[model samples]
Every structure is written in structure tokens, then in C-alpha cells.
Target: MPLLDATATHPITLPDGTLYRDTVYLKNVISHPRMEIGEYSYFTHCGKPEDTAEILAPYLGHSVRERLVIGKFVQIARGSYFITSSANHPMTGFTTYPFRIFKPETFGYKDLPVKDTVVGHDVWIGHDAAIMPGVQIGAGAIVAAASVVARDVPPYAVVGGNPATVIRMRYSPEIISALLDIAWWDWPVEKIETNLAFLETGDLAALKMA
Candidate 1:
């Protein structure tokens, strides 16, 4: 049996002529409408990616609408799960029982203010990582495997561990600044191909000249 339906929708193609489906290591069970995944950004669900809208009142003091925005050229490894709004529950109640969720007529849904989880361009997320909601991962950040990201990650920083602390920066401060200014991820396909050598060689002079 196929992992995804034959008629399932796919919108992006990678540099090596592979569809996003080919790179996705897990099952594509749901179509995410609340997610705005940009060019070349992909995820592996481990066959259990979260895409639910129902937020239990116990988990959340109120109901919340989840949104995920991923930017271009992002690399996501297998077994990575994004925590959706459904998983973010209230933390401060005498009893965590979400009676309001069961009895909507008796208690109307309360709205919880949850911001979108934003992943910036050229970021790399390693295997089995769990990214929490409302976290903003900056451009060119590297998330180590098995990490649980709960906060904002700075641009070009490498982070790891349960709470995802910064391990190091990918490059020197000057280099990071230069790379961010270059914004190669935003370059056109033809330009990227043309300057691929400079990118591959770390030849800043060549890139600048081009």
C-alpha cells in the first residue's frame, strides 16, 4: 500500500528532481491547511505528525488556533514532530479536567492567545526533535537530534538537548552577518545554480564578485 493517496496534493520540487513526498520518510496522513511551508521546506512525521485543531480546555486555559510558518531551504530530518495547539494545555488549575471541552453548551470555548511557530530560511532540524508552539527558530539555525525546542533560537546558532540550548554558532559573527546579508536562499534557481560553486567552496570573495 502507498503511504499517501495517489490523488494527494504536492506543491514543491527539490533540486535533485525529487518530489517532497520522495524525501518525506513517514506517512502523509493529513493535509495541513494552517501550515504555511515555504519553498523546499519539508518535514518527516514518523507517521504521527500532529495536525489537530481541538485544544483540550485542561491543557489550554482556553481554545487556541495553531499556525506554523516555515521558510525556504529548510532541512528537516525524520521523526521530527511539531507540537500543535491540541497538545498545549493549561498549566495552572486545581483540577486539569477539561469539562468545558466536553460540555460546549454549558461553557463556551475560551480563546487562548497562541502565536505561530516560525522556522526561518536555511534552517536544519535534526532527527526526532520536538519543536514546541510559539517558538521562533531563526535563519540558518541547526537543531540537533532529539532536541526539544521551547524558545527562540538565534540565527546561525546550533542547539541541542531536551530544552534545546545553544551549542555553538555555525560560523563566526562576521561570517554569519555576511551570509545573512547574502541571503542566498532567496536567490533565483538559475542564480543559485550559477553560484553553487562559491557556496560549495566557501569562497566569499567569489560570491561577492558574482
Candidate 2:
């Protein structure tokens, strides 16, 4: 049997068997490349068209510039925005206005600082949240609603607020370590399916036995 039902029109199966669809409202209106969505990761918009997710500031005409990488089983809620580039104008000059942006001869794309925004496995990014440029979110982190994350978030942390701050760790270090070692997201589909109950119960022994 095929890992994906390719006959579906909207959400297509990615190479890793993840069901993915671009934010339909942004199609043709925006320049985002098709995201490398990991297995079982999906966006929940709560039926609001205005709530959307896209790669921020994709390079003009497929030039391989955007480097946002979201990992397996990442749950991104509606209205979450990932800032992919610094795009800071030459701030050292007298005026902040980007004179270089309009002047082709003066334009220097390389002068601006930009980096990848990487979301690790099993991350939960909340509604209307904004992930700032170069932020690396660790595995199993929970970013609360309306948070603006500007820095790196450690694994299994519960973060909230604008310019997000860590509220607490989800588990003790040992449990978090064990979970990381297990890396359930890397398991085969069949095995994942069979062990679904263990996820709810946090039955590490059962999962290990399987």
C-alpha cells in the first residue's frame, strides 16, 4: 500500500510521507516555496482564512534563499509567522531609509544578515505567534499563543508572552532525555500506529518493549 493517497487534490504527500498543502490563500499572491513539511505535521487555522503560515520573504523567483526548516510532527497553529531574514537596512548611515533598495548599483543583498529558522521535532508553535529571524526552537518546545520568539528555545520548554520567555520545562531532565533518545517521530508509520496508546499514557516501557 502506498504511504500516501495521491488521489487527493489539495494536500499532497511529501517525500517523507507527510501530508502537506500550501496555505491556499497565499498561493500566487506570495512567493513562498513549497515547505519541507515533516511527517504528520500540519497547520490548524480554525477555519479562518486570514490565519495563514508561509515562508517569510522567499527569494525572488526561486533563487534558493529561504532556509526555514520545520521538523517532524511539528504542530503549528494559525497565524504563526516565521521571520526568515534580518533585511536590516544600512543602519550606520544618517537615514534609516533604504536608498540601496531602489538603486540597483548601490544594492548589496550580502550586506544584510539572514539565517535559517529551524523548528525541531514535535514542536508546538501557537496561534498568531511570531518566530524572529535566526531563532532555533528545540524539540518538543511549546510556544504559547501570540508569543514573539526572538531567541533560541531549549527542548521541552513551555514559553509564552511577547518576546517569549520560558515558563517551565515539560518534564524533568531525565524524562526529556529518554524521550529524545526514543525519538518516536523517527519511527515507521506502522510502528507509530501500533504504539499510539503509549503516547497518551507516557508508557516508556511499553514503547521500548515494542
Candidate 3:
């Protein structure tokens, strides 16, 4: 019902720069400390979106929005850095000795032209990881801890590295083929609830397997 209880056991405050187009899309089933979070989402013990200690781990930036974009059912370990945007230096012909250095950011300093950090549903980011800007992490993907993601990840894929590389797909192309055909998650809630057991464990060899 209520997203948060003002009387939290510990300090909890609304986070800045975190926004959802629709509030109904945000859900908080558990509340203990003060943190800014999104819906159908739960932060891990150290998953506080801001402080990483009392609150969800925060980034180095002045605005939290430039750091992370989490999707439904994500589990991000502590000390993860999502650098969605930064002081991108003008490398071409500025000739200003150290152009990399930022200069009192102008009109475009606060927000990126395209807010492009994304995290898909049921994804898990391990401890001490970093996600870079303009990166789109696909649904049901797993990013191992201590990895660095630099490119786009495909759905249900697993990636890790200094510049994250696709180690492999979670499921064989065949298995995924059937699962896609069934598209069980799209089923009505009532239907899914009734068939949960089969969907969760049944090995789809195809046909009735689906």
C-alpha cells in the first residue's frame, strides 16, 4: 500500500534524481533503512541505491540519475559503480592543454543529451562492478562481480571483464526458442499462478514440453 513508512527503524529519506514515469511501477515490499528505490525492486543488504552503507550505494557524480538505471527484480551488490554519464572531454582540436579537465559545465552539464543507462528485468550485478554510459543491459542477464561493462548486452546473456565480453548465453538457442514461443511471463497472472510449478521446472524438449 504505502511505499515507505516515514517512521523507519533507521534513517530513510527520499532519494534525489530517481524518477519513474509511473509511480505504480515502483514497489517496495520491504523497508528497514532510509533509501531511494524503484518498484518491483528490492535492494540487497548493501544494495542501498545511494550510500552503499545505510542507503543504496551512491556514485561519484553530483546527481544520482547519471549513475544507474535499474530494472525490475535486480540484485546489485555493494560498491558497484554505474557511470552512466560523465564529463566527456572534447578530444578534437580544443588544443586546450588538458581538455579532459571540466570547465564549470555549461547548459548540457547537468543532464546528458540522452539518458541511456538501462537495466533489464531479473538481472543480477555482482559486487564491485562498473557499468558505463550508453550501455543497455538486457533482461534476465547476469553480470559477475568485479567486472567492467562497456558495450550492450543481449537478453539472458552473461558478461564480465575490464571491457565486458559475452562469455556465453545462459540457455542454448534451442531452449530459448521454445521458451520464447511459450512466452510464459506474458500469461495472465492467474494462469501463471496455476501453472507455476510446470513452468518453473519443466524441461522443454519441445512440443508438450512447452
Query: What are the clash counts of all predictions, listed in order?
Result: 4, 0, 12
- Sort all candidates by lDDT, best to worst: 2, 1, 3
| Alpha-carbon lDDT, every model | 0.68, 0.69, 0.57
| TM, every model | 0.74, 0.75, 0.59
Off by over 4 Å in 1: 1-22, 25-31, 45-64, 104-109
Q: Per-residue CA lDDT of candidate 2, range 163-196, in tens? A: 8999999999998998889998898877777788
User: Which one wins by lDDT: 1 or 3?
Assistant: 1
**lDDT of model 1, residue 76:** 79
Model 2 spans > 4 angstroms off:
1-35, 45-61, 64-66, 92-95
True-structure RMSD, every candidate: 6.6, 6.1, 9.1
lDDT tens digits by residue: candidate 3, 24-103: 21234332232234434444443333334233323234433343556654666655666645434334454524432336
How good is model 2 by TM-score? 0.75
lDDT of 1 by residue, 1-210 (tens): 322232333434568977664343111333445656666555543232233211101122223465777787677776676775555555566865656666658553345456778889988999888888789999999999999999899999999999999999988999889988888888776777788889888998787777
Q: After best superposition, candidate 1 residue 3: deviation in angstroms?
A: 25
Local lDDT at 204 for model 3: 59
Question: Of models 2 and 3, which has the larger TM-score?
Answer: 2
